[model samples]
Target: MRLAVVASHVIQYQDPFYRRLAAHPDIELTVLFCSAEGAKTYHDVGMGTTLRWDLELLQGYDHRFLRNFGWGEGFFRLVNPGLVPTLVRGNFDAVLFMTGWAWLSAWIGFAACRVARIPIFLYGDSSYVPDEKSVRAKLRAAVMRALFGMTSAFMISGKLNGDYYKHYRADPRRFFPLPWAIDNERFVEGSAFAPGERDAMRERYGIAHDELAVIYSGKLIERKDPMTLLRALARMTHPAIAVFLGDGALRADLERYASHGLPASEPPSFPVSQEAGRPGGSAKSRAAFVGFVNQTDLPKHYAMGDAFVLPSHFDPRATVVNEAMACGLPIVITDRCGPSADIVRHGENGYVFAPGDDAALATHLDALARDAEMRARMAQRSREIIATWSYAEGVDGVAAALKSIAGGEQT
Candidate 1:
């Protein structure tokens, strides 16, 4: 089978999945990128940093960079006219579009594939539950419904992602199960840190062995609501550490909250200070504001955490959750995250709370922190869950999609 993957750029997470797909003996894969955004050092608006991914994204995969007509990742900005000609020349059995109609290039590729009568498999992280319900939202939903109908098949990223297409009235048989995932082998193997190395990382953060480290890894942007974790940690009665592994515009405020509790004038979000039985205080727990950690170094950082938390206002699919699970850390994430609906079994592998529900978040955090046995059990369960959601599953979905489509030319 010859497969062509259309994407915006070289994402650090997706690169490994692409490599896994390319390595399949029965398949030949070629990735057509609209730009080289992540290939070179660039400014990331969310993370508030300028850096290139440390990993080699192009190796172990066949790929090409198309001529980009615009500058950034905007719907219209990612226009790539060269895709039409490239598709014609590549003679690919099918096109795997990694995006919806968010980019002009997606529409262009759709048109080209439709004319050539080649099946197009659509894959994305969009969930059924949207953040807003407005006039514009309705219009976008209508557009997506049409987009979903036109695609030959859907590569379901998660339960919520599958729900999205179903809500759009997409055919049920067209769904291919490919859970949102990470390179589990790398994280599982790489995160096996030497006891001394783990201790050194904790020492660097001033996190005593007695303190439970609640790790938060991602951009510290408002959408991710990094402060919720801070506020939750502040409410903890026992000694715990909030370890932020990424940086963003919210860094300074997070640092400030680490030093001082939620501002008094700001009207407390969590009833930590005035709680009935619990010892009241102003951000009693400490925090380690470790700046942006790269791809290769993430496993070690993940290994140091007692538990992982993602307090996002909304995330289509939080890949960091997958990475943390692969590293054998239990999860505590917001319900708004797509992975929360699928990977995170409430009170099983980890817990799930509503976005901004600091009380619930704090309560869950406290439960994990207070019990060493529970944390270890949940951590083991996390590894078990992640084992099923790996790059191999992603490839299986692609191969299934390829085989289902007409003229797929499977070996």
Candidate 2:
């Protein structure tokens, strides 16, 4: 089976999976990138940093970057005139639209595939979370219904995402669970630190062995709610270390909160780079703000910690949760996270607190911090859970979906 994957850009998380798909014996895959803006170093508005991915994203894959005539960043801003012609000329047996709604080029490619009578596979991470009833959402739902009708099958990321496709009237039989996974082997390998190496990492990060390290990776933006994690850790009576591993617009305010206890009036001004080093506060309540850690070095940070936390106010699906789980670290995520249901077994692997609930987050952190045995058990469970969600699983899901569609089995 020959497959063409149309995406907005080469994302660090999805690139590895695409490589695996390309390597499948029964499948020949080619990735079509709408923008190469992220190929080199660029300013990420969300991460609030001018950064370049350390790992090779385009390697080991059959891919090409389309001519982009669009201005600005993000999927909505990308415009590729060559997208439709490329799809029509690729002669692919199937075309997978990775970001149909976000990119105009993707929609054009989808239409090209439809016109060419090629099987269309719709892959997205959207979930069926309830929101305020609005005409825009309703119109979007109607658009999705039409798109679902045109597609041959759906490749869902998780249970919530599958529900979302169903809500848009996608055939349940045609929905395949191609989970949002990461490079599990790489993460596991990076996580295997020698005894002395682990100690060195602890010393370098100022994390004492006696103090439980609760790590939070990803952007320190308002949506991620890094402040809530700080407040929660401050509320804890236990001797724990809170480490924030990414940078964003909230860095200054977070640094202010870390330096002085939650401010009474407004947050004090601090340079963004100030938080890159150790922030301020009491010894027990102090938080380490290690700015952006690259993909290659992220596992070491995860390995040094007892547990991982992502207090996202709203995340489609937190891939960091999968990364932490692969590193044999239990996760403490908010209910708003899409992977919370799939990965967080609740009191088994880790706890799931309500969004924006600092007290509840503090309670869970206290439980994991005080009990080393529970943390170990939960960590083991996390590894067991994440093993099921892997790049190989996604490859198999894609192959099976294609095979079923070829055999005229898609409903």
Please tell me which predicted candidate would have the highest TM-score against the true structure: 2
- Predicted structure with the largest lDDT when compared to the true one: 1
Worst window of 10 by summed lDDT in candidate 2:
263-272
The clash numbers for all candidates, in the given order, read: 0, 0
| Candidate 2 whole-model C-alpha lDDT, 0 to 1 | 0.81
RMSD of 2: 4.2
What's the TM for model 2?
0.92
RMSD of each: 5.7, 4.2
lDDT of 2 by residue, 135-254 (tens): 987787788789888778788898889888888788888877788998888999999988699877765666656667889999978788988988887778776777888899998888
Estimate the TM-score for candidate 1.
0.91
Candidate 1 positional error at 287, Å: 1.1
